[model samples]
Target chain A: MAELELSGVSKVYGAFNALRDVSLQIADGEFAVFVGPSGCGKSTLLRLIAGLDPVSGGRIAIGGNDMTARQAGQRPVAMVFQNYALYPHMSVFENIAFPLQMERRTKDDIKREVSRAAEIVQLSTRLQDRPAKLSGGQRQRVAIARAIVRKPGIFLMDEPLSNLDAALRMEMRAELTQLHRRLGSTMVYVTHDQLEAMTMADRIVVLNGGRVEQVGAPMELYHNPANLFVAGFIGSPPMNFAAARVDAVEGHAARLTVEGLGSFAVSYDGKEVSAGDAVTIGIRPEAMLPGAGEAGHLSFRMTPETVERLGLHTIVHAPVGAKTFTALFNGDPRMARGSALDVSVPLAQLHLFDRNGAGRSIRDIQ
Target chain B: MTFRSGAADAPAFNQNLGAYLFLAPALLILFLSLLLPAAATIGMSFTDISFLRPTNFVGLDNYLRLLSDGRFQQAVFNTSYYTLGVTLPTMVLGLLAAVALNRRFPFRVAFRTIFYLPVLTSLIAAAVVWVYIYEPYSGPMNGLLVSLGLPPQPWLQSPNLAMTALIIMAVWRDFGTAMIIYLAGLQDIPEEIYEAARLDGAGKFAILRRITVPMLSSVTFYLMIILIVQSFQVFGAIYVMTGGGPLGSTETIVFQMYQTAFGYTEFGYAAAMSTVLFFVILLFSIVGTKIMRKGEA
Candidate 1:
């Protein structure tokens, strides 16, 4: 296994910058995920590392070797495409044996290695069948079988499970994680699904507008998102942001008053803040449980627009004046549409952002 | 045929009558142009239907004569040679051109249009142009050969070279068709397959062989059948440039049949030849279609 380092890596397509000066280091055997929204340059960065596309600037090193100029085949990397991309004409045995055959191994060696890979993928019985005869999951196994047979230092998976149904995607997600653990190979997975990133990644590199927003463990990113974009992009029923003004500053505390929400006492680090300074306040949907509360808490009065009862959880979409956001609570079937409710956000769980979208949490300030 | 309006959920008489009226025009044309001639040809093959003589039913006389007909055998041999010669080279050239032009580059459209121009040109016009190019002394082909320090040789005049020369010209004229069809086939292959192949350590030639060629198999079979059938009816170029040649080396089945029916008025023998050629083409088509379907399976 080898560490992969991309320093100041960038990609430009004519006037558009797909990725700009983005750098990341994936340690050996780390399950690193590049997660972002659509058009957020996650796939572009993976393609650059895979050598499928050229980087317009900067360097890529694999195991501390300069692999920036290496062709895809010359690099110690194997990729599993999003579509599986199994050779439709070849049988499963040959599909897994392709890279070995390319290296011109002996016939016995090829047969032995291919069977071993097939057995690992639980595809031993279907080795004689062509890819067209296999189901989607089995075909993906063949693609995986093909990749692992080469024993490459890194496995580049680009949304490999996205083509499957939801149940199958979950199953494959767990299987891929197990595979990574068993093989101990560095895998750089890319996806737009935040849930997948949270569940699978050892460390996630959140990308936005071709720039690195944050790189941290799943819990770290969830608990402390560095900026407004990460805070909104990382979690389901994302943290809410509302306009607030500093009403008073006394010693090490600041009392911020939101327009429709009530005032909250936030810990003030030694930063210059006077009255009427504009700031954006963030509170997660889970933090806003339906309750009655007092100080050290931020209050919100919302009118429910829609309610979704998902058996285990209930999501209430509400409007606080002009801002529309959703709140999650235990499945409360009695929650009705158009109902007015007051939910309190605990002050310690609240997040604050200045006008420039840079984040500030109470832990850093206190 | 019985038309009953009494079957379960059958259409009423008026709707059925209207449907027949809607389909009658096309059916009438199909019967007149296709069915009638095919039936008549089968019938006439069993009898002597020469206009110069009273018709007589001769069941197996022409068939028995065809068993020993030397010139007809020679025509069959020449046609088979020309078919093989034309079909293979045309597909190879067409596939090469299609692959070369598949990627984006400056003037790609212009190059594609240039390659496709010969397919749109009239057959007689193209043949005439080829004839001039194959001209012994004045042609650019021999002129270039001489300038390259090689002796100028007759292109379409030599008996041994005439059929080969015709085959080359036919490949040049018709590979454009193969190119167009192969281009459409090439677009259907997903880009990820090639990327996967490359990651599998397949170099340029291996990707072409292992991915591109296998992916385009059905298209290759289709073009092969088309070129085989078209070349089996090869008459225009032979008539224009070779006229069955100095030693009848370029004489094909259709060209020989044409000479027998029109030039010699041997209508009975020519009809027999036409019937044999029809079965030969039918056999090739059936075999090709079966193989293609098997490949699909």
Candidate 2:
């Protein structure tokens, strides 16, 4: 277990920048996940930490030792790749025992460690089988076991469950969480799936365009995002944004006029915005109700376009004015297409962003 | 519309007809070129068939004569020596060269073209070029040896060195085919397997031994079969370079077959030698296939 730190790490390929001035610190035995869309440099950051790739600038330290120029084998890190790159010729036992063999351990020590690692991954009976004989999930377990036998200071996983099916991915996600708990090893994982990041991470680092947007606990990001990107990216059905203009500014209260809805008052004392400034209002799907009779009723008429019935909950897509929005309901609603209905947007649950897409803190805004 | 109950049976008949039509040209070519000549050879092996006379039945006389002929025995020993000497080294060298060139490098295409150039050259032409280079007095090889303070010894003119010279030329001219096959085999290995090996803490040599060699067994078997069969029938280089000279040290089985059938007009003895050579090649091929299958299992 170690505390890994990256200080001003940057990777440049010719003239194109893959990562720029990215710095992060992961404490000892913490499970940190890097989440982003494709081409956002999440995988590059993980590779840099794993020493699989070189950093063009800045330093990387593991366990208080600077290891910026060390090779991947010299670094105290083990990586489990997305493809589960099991050696095709070796049996499962050989694959897991390879690291111990490299360290020149005795036969008894190698055998005991390999079996112990395999038992942790529930692969004791599969030690004699080759990789080709295993299923996708089993191959992934073998890959994880290969990493665990090394007893490295940090575990790096680069989208390790992306190749498995949905059910297997979920199962392995839980298994990995449990593994982290048992081993108490510092782990840095990278994935494009937000759900995986939210469910499995002690701290989630959201990246966009090769830059770190926010770093916080999963629910911290959900409840209080730092920017428009994190607000739109960290939820199941994404948050909705509508253009609005500030109507009136008073002490701690600002009236805003949404494009389709009527004018409403919002608390905004910390925000430096005048009365006619442009701002965007964000609302979660579950926060909006399908009724016009409410105290803070920012109501609008919309035609229900599509209704997705997902057993426990239903999502209704409705067209208001020229924009489309979705609302999540607890049960199935008997709403027909092309029928007009009023929807409410709660004032406290609305997120406000400036013109530059930076979130105005709800508490700071008041 | 009525659903036909026997559509499956109709497809089966159609499939057989289609398969026969697809195989017609290959089967016809095999019948004309391979099967007919094999059947004629089997018949001729039992007879004394001279070029200008009626074929006379010899029954086992050709086989009996082959057992007593000293030149034929020398031919068989020389052929086996050549096969063992060339096949193993050629397969090993070709595999090494293929693996070295498999990675991305500067001017890789040019290197491949240079390596494959010898295989495209005619065997007679290659032998003629090598004969000049192995000249005892003024050849480039002897000159370099002399400059290096070594004795300038005869290469093809010595009985002990003539077979070695021919083996060198044969390996140089034939290793390109093996290299190409090994290159294809190396490419078939998925990149993920190599990545996994690195993660397993395997160094370069261990990965080559534990992963590459085992994966390329099939290609090795294929290359050995072709090299062995070709070694048995090595005649063009012998004719162009040594003519089985220098006390007949380089006289392989095929060269003796050519001399007996065409040089001395002894058709029955040559046909007997050909049959024996065919069996030798067939035995090697079957053993190679069996070993490869066992390795895979």
Q: Highest DockQ among the candidates is held by which one?
A: 1
Model 1 CAPRI quality = high
The residue pairs found clashing in candidate 1 are none
Angstrom error of the Cα, residue B140, model 1: value is 2.2
Q: Distance from true position, residue A134, model 2, in Å?
A: 0.9
Question: What DockQ does each prediction reach against the true complex?
Answer: 0.82, 0.51
- Cand. 1 Cα-lDDT: 0.88
lDDT per residue, candidate 2, A48-149, as tens digits? 887778999999999999999987778888989898877777799988888788788999999999999999999999999988899999999998999999
lDDT per model vs. reference: 0.88, 0.86
Interface root-mean-square deviation for each candidate?
A: 0.6, 2.0
Name the top lDDT candidate: 1
TM-scores across all candidates? 0.95, 0.93
Q: What pairs collide in candidate 2?
A: none
Candidate 2, residues B1-54, lDDT tens digits: the string is 233344755656566666778799999999999989878877788999978688
